[model samples]
Target: MDRPSVRRLPRGRHALPPERVARAQRDRLMTAMAEVMSEKGYVKTSVEDVLKRAVISRQSYYQHFTSKLDCFMAAFQRSTALLERQIVEAAAGAGGPVERFDRAVTCFLETLVSDPATARLCVTEVYAAGPEALEHRTAFQQRLGDHVADILEAGTEAGRFTCRLIVAATATMVSGPLLQGDHDALRSLGPRLVAHVRDLKAAGLL
Candidate 1:
């Protein structure tokens, strides 16, 4: 008689464990931190505020993160990752380099528009968090800049767009505006922004 074969589990499907529970709790706290920070600003948002919103104990919170800033950084990083994934996937499916660039621009704007509070936190409160948060923000910008450069370089090489300026500098310009809290204003800026990126000299992009 032969031994029975074990069935394979699907991707991302596995038995729950203590680590998973801990992660879930941490995610809840981060989400709550975003909401509370948006409402009260980072300086005013206490650990108790997050605890109340997350429905977790103070001990549970400390178990996952060292402090409020730590939790905020985790939330910022997670949100940034999600935005990057959406933009990349959208750009990848487009027909050509220019189209990919346009799709990425749209996705980037929409991500901020869909969540004004998160946008506000990133723009205004993140710097106020502390030195560590500022360092994280700089690193985040560097990573995003590299991604933007890859897209622009592809388009430039394909002769679909002109990129005379430094790629990193241009990417930083593209990212700076999306941090605004006013969705209505940002929506209006999208068309002009795209046009400016394409025709950089026309808009004094340098």
Candidate 2:
């Protein structure tokens, strides 16, 4: 997916509701936070940087988030939620389990590559946000792993464990390539990763 635009409203808006206006500004701030964090890393990013890119006022930023980390988590959660939805929707399509699994994995990697800024926030920079981010990451991994288990009809505990392994290994593979800016290599790994899951299942592992 493309990055969300840092769009603006007319100088004197007329018809848009208050809630709509609030959501638009929040989206811009989150988009700016993702992009700025991608470029500068979490430690180096400041509230001013986000406000600058978002073209939003400091007062507006405070209405939604208390700190830069709060903004970062908001963006992280939003981006990952979208990514998860894409995966689930892909897996829900017309196909057998393996095909659905492949579709979901392909969508996952393609999403990461298509929007590197958000990908960086979701994949790499979350680690820099401390314990709250770490807990969220763990929960995300477990939920995603469970999705994979569901795709494979893995009702047993062992099957779920194997799925967890798959998600962890897949994350490792993509993270290195993503951090290196090797987007082609990152996209190419999707098929191989899917194939690994197939191999594991074929061996009666999952």
lDDT of each: 0.66, 0.89
Cα deviation at 205, candidate 1, in Å, is 9.7
lDDT of 1 by residue, 101-205 (tens): 677767766766777556655555787898888887767665665565566553343232233233334344534454535566656555665566567534433
CA RMSD of all predictions: 9.6, 1.3
Instruction: Give the deviation of candidate 1 from the true structure as CA RMSD.
Output: 9.6
Determine the backbone clash count of candidate 2: 0
Model 1: per-residue Cα lDDT at residue 136 = 75
* Candidate 1 stretches greater than 4 Å from native: 1-16, 154-181, 201-206
Give the residue spans of candidate 2 off by over 4 A: none
lDDT of 2 by residue, 69-114 (tens): 8999999899888888889988996877778899988899888888
